[model samples]
Target chain A: MTRAKKTWPALVALVALVLAACGGNGATETPETPETQAPETTAEPFVFGMILVGPQDDRGWSQAHFEGGKYVEEKMGAQMIVIDKVNPADRPDTSVEQVVDQMVEQGAQLIFATSDDMKDGILAAAKAYPDVPMIWSSGDSAWDIGKAYAGLPNLGNIMGQMEYGKMMAGCAAALKTETGSIGYLGPLINDETRRLTNSAYLGARYCYENYRGLNPDDLTFSVNWIGFWFNIPGVTLDPTQVTNDFFDGGADVVISGIDTTEALVRAGQRSAAGEKVWAVPYDYRGACAEAPEVCLGVPYFNWGPSYLEVARSVADGTFEATFQWVGPDWSDINNPDTSAIGFEFGEGLGDARADLEDFIAGLASGEIDLWVGPLNYQDGTPFLAAGEKATDLQIWYMPQLLEGMIGASSAE
Target chain B: MKRALRAVPAVWSVLAALVVSVGLLALAGAPPFEALVLVLDGAVGDGGRMADTLMSWVPLTLASAGLVVTFVAGLWNIGVEGQVIAGAIGATWAARTIPGDGLVVIPAALAVGVVAGAVWALAAGVLKTRGGVNEIFGGLGLGFVAQSVATYLIIGPWKRAGIASTSGTEPFREEVWLPTVGGTRLSPVAVLLAVAVIFLVWALLRGTRFGLRLKAVGANPASARLLGVPTEATVLRAFALGGGLAGLAGAVLATGIQHKLVPAIAGGRGFLAILVVLLAAYRIVWVAPIALFFAILSVGSAQLQLRLDLDSSIGGVLQGILVLFVILIGGWQALYRRGEP
Candidate 1:
């Protein structure tokens, strides 16, 4: 009996561990039949995986990607397996390769690793699964002509030219700011982030001079970067607090360049308290809904059209590794089906809305050239000689911030 | 006979945990059986999934091995997490600064990691003996300090070139990584090290004079001192031993797993090791298998999220309840024994 008693507990513990499935009890109504592929018909559905860097409902960057995934499902009749909040602060040690392995095993025909932070993991996974087609958003790995090309035959890249959108955001801020100052809530310091911040400054400078009838040099544009894409409580400086600081420091308008909508949300809260301030949220078209009254507008990426093409190509067995930097459709920037980038005016655009539209029209018709010369780097080095237009390389690999911007050009 | 019978309460606790957990799952609205199948399939259903499980097992077993020494000394060295971080920092420093490639880098960097971890743990040991600070609080405070130091290095000095972000340092040079088996991420060296630590821990705690002294000091510090056992020294040594092991785990995380020094480098594996040690009833014999079990649950729970749309945290809740039930039943057994006496 004594020996039996000793053996019993060990056996029981093992059995309990191997058998206690945690809980799929309440998940009966769950729509997560991975093998069934959501449609039990004879025809097979194209299954793709989307690994997101933040919450799907974050109302910003990841949400835009999530909507893009949904668009693929709607248009191509594909099934998507999405996992979000793939960051250390959220679930530490869950590697992108591990997630990719699971997705591929479950028959993901293509994988979309969406987030600049996912660059390393996606590349590693691409090498591991050489047969699976992969799209890495906001990555330069597939740009054979660029410096960071990985030459992975299975990997391609897709990124919207959000520079134009940032310019629009800057233009609105320039037209609306009564204080002659615009604060940009930036996300990290890299070539990509630097270029976006510089783009916003250029738009602000152009509008503050020509459209608003003020000296572009007189507009004070300060860029403050919080180390990562989104706030991670202890690890990152709070975006809300940073937005408040911008308002408190006499900047009447703050434009966000991060993955979340803290700027517009904070501005709306402050506006509710009678503060005359506004914010421009980035990444998602519907971001203005958070604080429509205080939101000047939002500069967003529409990933749908690009994602749809990838899905179709993969399904039709005509996919090849390529790098695409999609831009807004000049015909109608708000056309959901065609435009890769957009800027939707908010209720807070108020009387300056028409001016912002005219500026947009000018950009569309090639009448306004923001990247044209006489521009200087932040450190006073000449970026463009007189009347010299920036080449694709100069714009894409912006090593420093522009002149007249108050921020660190590089990490050092 | 009595020793054999002592295992009865553990068995009943497992049974009770199973029942209560199944009930909880039912209340959660998930069909318990399907969820179990989901996690089981996710865990070791194939060679690849099994490899992932073993990868998680490496750091876990290492941390648990270290904790065994501390537990034997009756020390709650909660700063094991920080020691892990210190190890990672030390290894990262070697990866970046150590010049010449292949021949000497891996073992040399790991040796540095072990030293860094040992030194970090000794600080808590010194505090407990010299400053009248409890090991728990001192360890926790130091852990926070270590975390802050790591964050500073990542975002400030060791950050990626031209990138001011806390994502992590640049990936280690190709030579810095611990070699893996042919195609998978599994490192045979990491697994062997963990196995060696288990044997080392078993031998050191049960077969040596120092082990006897540690037990004496743990049982009664004054009594051990009266018996001329050098209680404080033994305690400090116990802490160093544990912290050294934890530092090795950190090295594995850096060189073997992450290949970079991330801010959350320890990945809370230190805390999970605490659970493994506890569930093992502080017995060294159970530590390895129990650590593997927990690793399986963790790796498999991802399947729960993917297949059933259930939160991965469901696995965490089950582990917590299992531990709780074991403690509760053991308490009841103790009370029953008291009544019998």
Candidate 2:
């Protein structure tokens, strides 16, 4: 009787173990049907992966890319695997390192690392697993050679020229600055922020020196580095505080170099409260709607054409690893098939919109260069000569705060 | 044999919960199996990932081991996270200003981290034991305050001169780097040092007269006080020691993994350490494996994110659920229920 009782419990325990194992196994099998069915209906086997810096719903930086990824998916009928909010501080390549591995293992042919910080990891991954094609956004020179180089035939970088939009934004800010004193909320004092600030300053300086006959020093400028890309509580880069400081220092026109729509919203609030602050936003796209009344204009990067062209090239196998630029002629307002730099001039433009449009036309036609001489950084250092346009390298790595900005040059 | 058989249900439940939680995450648009696979690969998959996992474990284990001493003494040093940040900041400042040989630099950096961590913890200890403030609130408030100080240092006068974006201490030289093991980033010295810390903690809690008195104070402070034990002082000392260990972990993180101090150097590990303590039931020896388990979960979350396209937050959710289930299922001393009682 005792033996029988022990046998019964043992048999029950074995059954229970089998059930638990089956329950776990059931989850793994869930995707099998869909994964098989997906290939049958689509008739295409191409799987592309994207690693994002933030959540898709962020409605800003990462959101723009997410929308682009979706666009590619729709146009190419491709399969996509997206990883979002990949914290850079967590590991070397963020979450892309593992995501790419999985995508490759699952037979994904192409992988896209959507942020500049992802460049190193993507390159490392590309070299380690050469069969996968890796696309990196915002990397300056992967096509060129360096010790950190991961020489994979399938890897390349894609970027847009938003500087033209920045210049237009500066034009709006310069024209509207009642104090002739505008503040810029710059995230990092990198080459990108430098040129964007410089372009804004160049346009502002052009208006102030030519139109208003004001001395450069009289147009005070302060630039504050938030020391990071986003507001991490207990860390640096609180845009709210920085914007408040700019307003406090008599900056009536505030331009943002940071990628978020936060500064524009804050400017709207400040304006509503009778502060009369105007904001010029960058990485444009939907930024005009962020605070249309207070938002003067937004310098947007049009990624549509570039994304379309890249997708077709990958399909055709004609894609080469080159540092390609999508600018001006390829991107302007009319071209539906190429990337371009342009901004949405807001309702507050009043009568200036027509004139601004004309100026943009002239800029597009190369009649004017914003950096034409007598330009100086905030510290009175000359950056451009009369009748000279800044080179790609100059624009790429522009250092120093431009004159008349309200903020520090750098953080630790 | 029967006693061992009884433990199977508890172990099986934990496994079941982990599997279910991971499946839920996969359903939320992640590849569940791949994520779990990658997590395994990252945590113990190979030498490289294992080293990385171990690298993360050093500070965690060190903090966990230290917490055991204070936990046994019945003082909850919830402020270990702040202490860790404080230690990192202190060590960073010392490493920056003090010039020395590589050997001296490591010790100096460590000392700076330890001292800073201890001092931050002691403040809470003093308030709790003497000022009669609850240790929980005292530690919580001070943690917030310490974070602010770290912010001021990074953003204000101490901000690195030219580098823009990212508030961080200046990077230390390669010479100042802690020694590593066998071509991996796992700092051998840190491991050795951690092992020593574990032993010291085990000895202090289980061996010495001080350990006995501390347990007495923890068990019944009033009774221990009546027995002429300086219960308050002992508790304060434990608090200070615990804080120092957390701080040391922070310092190690700054020096070892990151090489420069960023505000996020602690990375919520301090809070996780408390979970480790509870899961181990404050047992000195149980902390290691529990910490490793949590580390695997973390590493695994990253894997799931990559392989399955799941969000990294999913790992945290799964861990939270598992811990919650364990607590609920454990059900307050049910394991030790007696027929007489």
Candidate 3:
């Protein structure tokens, strides 16, 4: 028995050695063949690679980016390679840098790292591969503001004027809310999140006072930050619970700032259950289709034009890395033909459809200014002097909740 | 000769698994040989990648070492995952609430994590012993409870300001950040702690009377009772010891690697540790190397996606095949021994 036991260890060692030898042989033979597979066709079309933080069909954040890639593919004739669902939480073993490296090896000249969570990874890849131009979505790393920000020559950041979208969403909520209460289903507190929430609140308050002719003091705009972009059971608050809490707490309208359609879907269910609840979903154009019965409208991003412009500039060798925060074209704010921000009205808007359109027209014509304020922050600090309009920088770094909004600015 | 004869089946089983995996790659329309090369290259191609592999290896090895104790005691502590999260929760609480320098904060947080993990595991132990519940079911259920508690804290009380987010507590003060080696994932102190844990576990299992008595209880409870061995106390002790180590792993993961809590802070490492223990054949001596191998497979598989455009699930497939083969070979060996007798 002792001899047999000893023999097994030896046999195990032999097997390991043999396996290693086979693997070594395979490794040595691989590099040569892949290089030959590259097509000799005239300066291979700028292979633009995109890394999405969630699934392409998620119908929210990631889907918007995926559609942008498809747009570039169709309009610019760019070769697009997109890898979706690249979340750090899901793939702990893989890093963003490693994914970028793979894309670079696959002949991608330009890479778009989509999702705010990808900031660090995108920056690292930009530093590692200076020759490849990279664009990071919803990042401010390229801006010359903080010491942490770097001016990478090949790295640029692109984000839409989503505050405007949130503002419109807020207006829609205000026009639809029967209980004079609006619930903002927020995701994680950041400058971006706070600004969006505040914008929505401002929009809701504007319409409540001006359009609906209701006392602004009688309106309640509350935000419940679910602590993440989406529900991750046990690590973040369940969106359904937050939605239920909002509705149960007497909010008639819930505006979603999250990547998923939980708020809209939950509102739809509540409506089916005979509760008069309406929702405004954010991100993708098709988000309202999830539950048109309760979705008042959706404030969606039109990333196609912006993405195509960048890709074309790169292809023509006229690309300059810059922080681009594109806003809607005022002439046609909801024009799918030209505008970067488009508001699609859902079927849930019973009689508020025309009113909502009038509000949008007023907003586009500079007849409405949401930021014109003597606004106080959550701490009752003066956020804006009387009649002072916030600049892009001021709005981007919004510090706290606006006055009269009920919820903790920071986690308790 | 006997050892070699015994190893023969395991070697054959491994070879068979590899053959099966190659066939799978072919079915998926990938060049199996090239894919193998890419995995190896990605795993160990450079210093940075090696650091990442070792970074993953630490927590996995620590968790698997803990699992070995429970397996030896014949308890399926599937709640190890929850224990790890509980440990992270304890550690994050300390890091966030405690006002101290790294020296004071690191040890204090880690200690709390260990205690929290032990306490959590003890619940499963109590359920098994007193409530007549199977440890697997009890552990699994408790694991879910632990996850909910973590989520609640993150979203409710511990959430970062201006944005309650799954991003976890605004990263612990930089002063308390685990001292890493020049920005690489490798933390000297964390690695040393893991090695120290492995040694301690090994010594406990192989070089002590407690180990022998526990083995006796596991081998035959009735025989152990006849021999005046306190089986229940030994089993409970095993659960605590194993839980303590898993908690320490959670502390290391939180303070060392992640630097902040995410919902996926444990990242299924606790569950993966079960596979590590299995690959080591439940032997404490074999746990570290086996864990490292799995880490390599994990770290290297990213290249499969990059180089060959193969799905990352291929790595999971390879790991599953390896474990399946080992179990099959082990069963075959057992049957052979019975036949010979």
The root-mean-square deviation over C-alpha atoms between each candidate and the true structure, in angstroms, is 5.4, 8.7, 7.5
What TM-score, over all chains together, does every model reach?
Answer: 0.90, 0.78, 0.81
On lDDT, who's better, 1 or 2? 1
What is the DockQ of the complex in model 1?
0.33
lDDT values for all models: 0.84, 0.69, 0.79
Best by DockQ: 1
- Report interface Cα RMSD per prediction: 8.2, 12.0, 10.2
What would the per-residue lDDT of candidate 2 be over residues A64-137, giving only the tens digit for each residue?
Answer: 67667666766667666676666534332233555576567666777777775455457657776766667787
For this target, which candidate reaches the highest lDDT against the unseen true structure? Answer: 1
Q: What is the lDDT of residue A221 in candidate 1?
A: 94
The DockQ of predicted model 3 stands at 0.25
Ordered from best to worst lDDT, the candidate numbers read 1, 3, 2
Q: Give the candidate order by descending TM-score.
A: 1, 3, 2
lDDT of 1 by residue, B1-341 (tens): 76655655545666787688678767776788788777778878887778778888888888888988997777877688889999998888888788888458888778888888888999999999999998878987898888888878998889887788878898888887988776778888888999999999999889999999888887678899999999889999998889999999998888888889887788777776766676676678788888887788777877766676554456667766766676566656655665663
Q: Where's the lowest-lDDT run of ten residues in candidate 3 chain A?
A: A27-36
Residue B67, model 2, lDDT: 79
For DockQ, candidate 2 versus 3, the one ahead is 3
